[model samples]
Target chain A: MEFNDWAILEKRVIGWIRKAADHLRASLSNPLEISEKSAHNDLVTNMDRSIEQFLVGKIRDTYPEHKIISEEGYGDGSSDTNGILWLLDPIDGTLNFVMQKRFFAISIGVYENGRGRAAFIYDVMGDEFFHCLSGQGAYQNDIKLSPLTEIKIEDALIDMSTTWLKPNRRIDQDIMTEIVRKSSGTRAYGAASLELAYVAAGLLDAYFTMRLSPWDYGAGLILLNEVGGLYSRADGEQINILSRTSILAARPGLHEYMIQHIKEQVAEGKFLTEPQ
Target chain B: MEFNDWAILEKRVIGWIRKAADHLRASLSNPLEISEKSAHNDLVTNMDRSIEQFLVGKIRDTYPEHKIISEEGYGDGSSDTNGILWLLDPIDGTLNFVMQKRFFAISIGVYENGRGRAAFIYDVMGDEFFHCLSGQGAYQNDIKLSPLTEIKIEDALIDMSTTWLKPNRRIDQDIMTEIVRKSSGTRAYGAASLELAYVAAGLLDAYFTMRLSPWDYGAGLILLNEVGGLYSRADGEQINILSRTSILAARPGLHEYMIQHIKEQVAEGKFLTEPQ
Candidate 1:
């Protein structure tokens, strides 16, 4: 891909996302064939696969050289990560879509040589588009988002699933409870992509989750990067773009404090899914 | 008040709530003078006072014989729970208002001889108005809400602040943790009124909070009552409409199961605030 060619590619990506969102809105009223993937709560609907097909089809037709990674197995099983890669999650919060019918998003990120070039997270119900380029500023519905500044841990509002604070194999419940008790408040919106978008927009101060796939945080990481937000795995290692891992994303100062506390309290060699 | 007077009173109360919502929306753009009350997380703003004054003045002018109770000191300090009582919370989820500038609401409930006559919870920013008259059914922006049916605890989506699941004086941490583990999911939106409105709308299955003032849960209980939802304290006692108490509200069968489990696990006479 040429340097100047990136401009035309972004427009094409955003156009595809908008088209995919239309299909999602149309599926709201009609009956959906729902099934559990691995766990009972891990739901997947037909719309998830349909939207992925629509976007993946458009991408393959336009850029045949690009490789794809998606939630619904739209790509070949391979370990190579040396080309232009597209990470996509057609419906990030599938449970929310299945039960509440809202708070879900379509997330996609374009990477070159494992480096993000463009990202978009479309909130289908709210119709808010949060997107960003590699080094350029992030935007929500064409309005530029301000760069994040330092925030104190005492005043921070952490967004996390309560399951982590409950007894879990990944980490001790007491350790996570201390982190929540020290924060000003907590919210669990049940979507990683939208939760990360909230951190980029400064609506939420931090987000922590036990495990997420590459597609869950791919677009969010790009958006957070442009806004000066920070992210890393539980063990204080850089996140792998091709594997599942625990996540802790926040603004500059608070991330350091939270990650240090997590590292200090995480059990020795007992994390349910360690960062690889 | 006469039987037909209830009909005219409902119109006036709803009208006043809409006007109050407009003032709240306007305050969103203006600078708010904030101060902490009791605790750092317990935030109150200048808009709270101004809105309370506006609504209280209207109630006095229209119904001089009615008694009032409110968050701010707009009502006379008294233990009287008789006559046509009006309970008002000028702004519930004050922290959400001061920080996110959304999710807070103006909550009010009207009662005659300790029985609710009408209730309203208005989400100002989202422009959603949830209201109901006694035995007339609930409505969200003029759309009638359906009556709630039985649901199992395993499929329940419980809404509660994470603080309760942490080490607390009211109940043992393990007890609350069990409830969360059995439930499908949990959310903390930081607004009691909106959480209850979600219950009335069937978006959430149950709501559990340790302590809430009458003003916070007044309108919500009425809205839930019309939809055939159930409520009580953690100790299986009726809620006193004049005092602060622990709240556990859910659909019929789920509430019975949860309250029994809670009563069995809570330490003997250790609940921080018991229902009087």
Candidate 2:
């Protein structure tokens, strides 16, 4: 896509995200009608679906040719990212939105011909908008964010979910435990996009989680790419945006160190997947 | 202390905490002069001590007879809580303050005759002030907070540090891991006072951490007390306000459930302290 096209799309998308945020704020006054997704802990609410549909409608109206991959079934389900692809997570942290009525976000990533072109994550309650254009620097609410410098493991504060520390099917608990022990601190905000935004803003050094979908970290990945951050599968492989996989994202050296640590555990036959 | 006295003191202390918050906001504009305390991860900063001294000075100038037990050296170091006592943590999440420039808090707990009388925890950047008196309910920025209802373990969202989930010297990591797997979700805000306030506000069902000082949780305890929250050492014993100890604070039923779970681990010999 041309730079002019990217700028126009970015401006329109920001307006759409702000409008969706207003809808979210209005919906919070009423009691949420929540339902379960894959598991009881995995939740979806009326607002999640409504917001996703709202974004999908806006996207379809604005760019009729663009395909969308989104949560809540408001997507084209295109197998290949051949053209303009929009990945949308209308309510990234639905649990927080339903429970605390805050800490959720609207995340959107735009890709042209399978290449990231622009991305945006709007923290609805905090009123902070993080955005980036491919090859351009990321910004937090108009201020350009600086690239994260390399941090020592002992000085790093990691962002991870508690589920990864238990006997889960994805990775070994012992390996995850070592990372927790080695890092200076760990935080779990229950919002992948916000956590990724924090990584881009240098608020957190890294964030890793097992079993996240494309919409969960789609915009985050684009934002991180602009800020000199790295992301990969838990076993040090490239992440497939269409598949559910474990993720480890961090600044340059820390990402390499974590990947090395996890690889060593796998080599020692300690990192296990669930038995078939 | 009399209700009249409590009201007057609460007004005075709120002013002091707000003033300290303003000072914290101003200090963030300058580079932090950070130093280590006990270990590399254990941090202290110039603002921590300066904020403590400022609060101490205010307390001394207003009520010279009150004794203080604080993180920095400005405390009276009184062992006995016989008279009026002030427990202060100028910056509860110093790491967050120094790193994220947000999420930290100014915590102050006022006790009279060994009982919590009034408390305050101010989120400096968020501009949220949580305060409470013994009999009255808690207030977050002048809005009175409601009491928390009973929550089931399966539906609980816990606030805990990742350090406690590993093989630490305090409690068994296996037991903590089970709690994590069972809870609905887990969050680590990296600030004890803010986490405690979150529990009181019903944003999180519980918060637990090992080796917290009196200054770290004193204000939070008071706020939780007003909202019918229960707190104790992880081993189900009363927390000593003068020493470092593990804390498990939650709504009524969930607190009991967690305590019972921990005790069961102890009975099974799975809970272990480091070999002395």
Candidate 3:
């Protein structure tokens, strides 16, 4: 499809997705049906599955040739990103949504041949949506986001979980400590989609996570690109939209500085372990 | 005053406080008139003092005998909690209000003869008001909250910030590390009022901080007490509402277990200084 056609389709899809999510929120607000997934911290409720199913059905009926990769099992098990692929995280931050009843999001990204073309992140309770069409620009609701400009580390705030600083299976602690000490402030909002949205909104300067799936970050990638932000693996490698990747997305100047100094320091002697 | 009279007063005060907070939120959407306090983190805007002044003025006009203790310098500087004393934190998270425009609260507590009679925690953006009147049940909005009962440390979610976990002037990190490992999860929302409100609501099983002032936790203490939740110094000592104190508020079962093991450990020369 042409760029204009894709933009129109994306706007309509985002509207539908917003309506479906609002419906799900209303249905599950009073009496929620909850369940545990990988662990207690990883909570998935009925609304997650239902929302994913609704999105998948809508996409199937409207765009028959499109493929979907979703958090829930409703999507196809396709490994290729050659055609138009829709990535869906129906309920990002499920634990936050289930326990806190807030701070969760519905994130969707449309990509063509591994290049992100459109993105949408809807913070349900806040009724805020961050959207971007490739080369057009990023927006929150009706307001267009300004392109990220050069900001020093001391003037910038980084959004990252403290777990990254701990002795986890992801990254080195000493390097993470150096990064934290350099930034003005560090925050972890528990939802990757919202974190990405905040990065686009210029509320936060950067965000880095060790383990994240396509569903978690696909939408954010499109928004970041449009707002003059860059995303890469921990070793400064390009993110493969088809799989889980250690990701970092930041403004233009900060991204380069982070990769050369902190990223390299964190990945010292272990760069071979990163994807080729 | 009699219990029925106290109840009536609580209802009226809560309504007035809610109205006052809404007015502040609407009026102070931007920091066009902002200033610095003790430090950059300790932010104060015109609205902070204005809101406190309005509350104190209304309280004195409505009931001339009532005393007021507040963060802003608008209340009487009485040392004793004689008659009805109102504790006010006009904007509990001023840094958040000025910086993020969200994640802040208006905390108010009513005390009679040094005893808490009522508390209100208004999360302005979230539109959640957690409240309690002594002898009555705690509530999030209108729904009566369940009491703290039978929570395992392994299942408990604790509230804390990474800043505290680091070597700080106030707290010993050895015990904090153990607390981190033992709890199911840790969260830092940067707003003490809402954190305490969550503890009262049972969403967060526990919350603690190295230092907190009276205004930071007055309303939270009242709400937690109503739900049979415990709030004390980390060493299991009483917290003086007039002074800055170390805070440890948690569900009854987890509170005792944590204090006995964690707090006592820190006291018994098991301190681990944060990494250099």
Candidate 4:
């Protein structure tokens, strides 16, 4: 990688994100064309499609050699994460887009040779732009983010969807129930990238969720990496990035503590990720 | 009540709340002297005490005959809400102030003869002010909030702390778990008043919490009432201003559905509020 490659790529990615965000912010006044993907709760909107298309178009035109993986069906869907790769979630919280009108985000991560090169998470309504380049500092808008300091689970503020705390197919509900009861507090923003950005920016101590697609998971990993944060599959394994898995991202000590505790729970025989 | 009572009181309350909000925002740059309240998870800050003192001073100086109820020990300790009553949660989400540095709010509600006359919930860092004069529509910042339209539980975006979904002494965990699985999405902002404001602004379809004091409960009720929303105890009973009770606030149809569902669950005997 060239010295100026980071600067140029970061600028171009941010520019595309800002362009898409501007479109989204402006279109809030207009009616959205929405359709459910699988369930009524799982929503997809025209804004999601348009933003994905716009970003994919920009990437394909400028970096034609790049492979794209995205949520809204514009991706190349290459079998492996080789060469240059772009992972995008045009709207991280589609329900938020239609219902809340805020808290939704556009997430993009650029990877080269299966390593993160640059990542951006733009919160469209709030105008909070969280981004980072490999080995450089993470940023929420203009201010550079500080590396996260160690915190205990007792002192930490955790963010995760409440659905995970209920009886679910993903993981044992008791596992998260214990964490929520022990943590300083818990919040659920319903947007993966923004919640992860909050971890990087120190607004949240950690954010863990079950089974996020690559588009929802990739950019957040890069942001956390830039902030000296740690992440793994919730069952304490390495993230495959290509497969949907539980994500647990936190500061150094809390990450390890959570992973170890989760492992201990799994060892207890009833707290495994997959229930029979 | 005088003819000009609503107009005059609304202006004065907004003025005081904004003054308190400005103070909170300006002091955000300074370090807060924070201490745990009941436990490590429950926090209180010098900022909280100081804000309460400031608002209490203002109210007392303005209306000596009126009674004050507040968090952080600035209350009059009045047993009932008879004549002019002022409820204040000088800093809601005190942990957010110390840790996240955002999402905390200054909430104030004025009641005349046990009826809500005016209310305000201001987000200091985000600078969104949710206010209302009873019978005169709610407003989020300068924009007038629309009356909540009917929404189904399946389509509603709900907000509440995830802690309520766990096994607790409050409501049955399965009750909220069912609500979580049925709702389109759920969010927990960690501030009760701000979450209620989001509901009034139509950003969320509903917000429910296990228990809240009158200071945390009053301003939100006024905001919801102004926007034609509904609220009752999570057990489907009328709220008593003097007591800490579970609050189930929502738009018209969804609110009824939740209450009825919770009642049915309670009737099953596994879902009672207090176990024998």
Please report, as a residue range, the 10-residue window in candidate 4 chain B with the lowest summed lDDT.
B267-276
- Per-residue lDDT over B13-123 for candidate 1, one digit per residue giving the tens place of the 0 to 100 score: 889888888888877888999998988788889999999999999999988888889999897644876788889999999988887887889999988888988999998
lDDT of 1 at A275: 39
Backbone clash total for model 2 is 0
Most accurate candidate by TM-score:
2
DockQ (CA atoms), all models: 0.76, 0.82, 0.33, 0.88
Candidate that scores best on DockQ? 4
lDDT against the true structure, each candidate:
0.86, 0.88, 0.80, 0.86
| TM-score, candidate number 1 | 0.95
* Candidate 2 Cα errors over 4 Å, as ranges: A1-4, A272-276, B1-4, B272-276
Q: Against the true structure, candidate 2 has what lDDT?
A: 0.88
List clashing residue pairs in candidate 4: none
After superposition, which runs of candidate 4 have C-alpha atoms over 4 Å from their true positions? A1-4, A274-276, B1-3, B274-276
Residue A90 of model 2 has an lDDT of 92
Q: Worst lDDT window (10 residues) for model 3 chain B? A: B267-276
DockQ of the two-chain complex in candidate 1:
0.76
lDDT of 1 by residue, A51-90 (tens): 9888889988998888899999986534667888889999
Lowest-sum lDDT 10-residue window in model 2 chain A: A267-276
TM-score, predicted candidate 3 vs. hidden true structure:
0.89
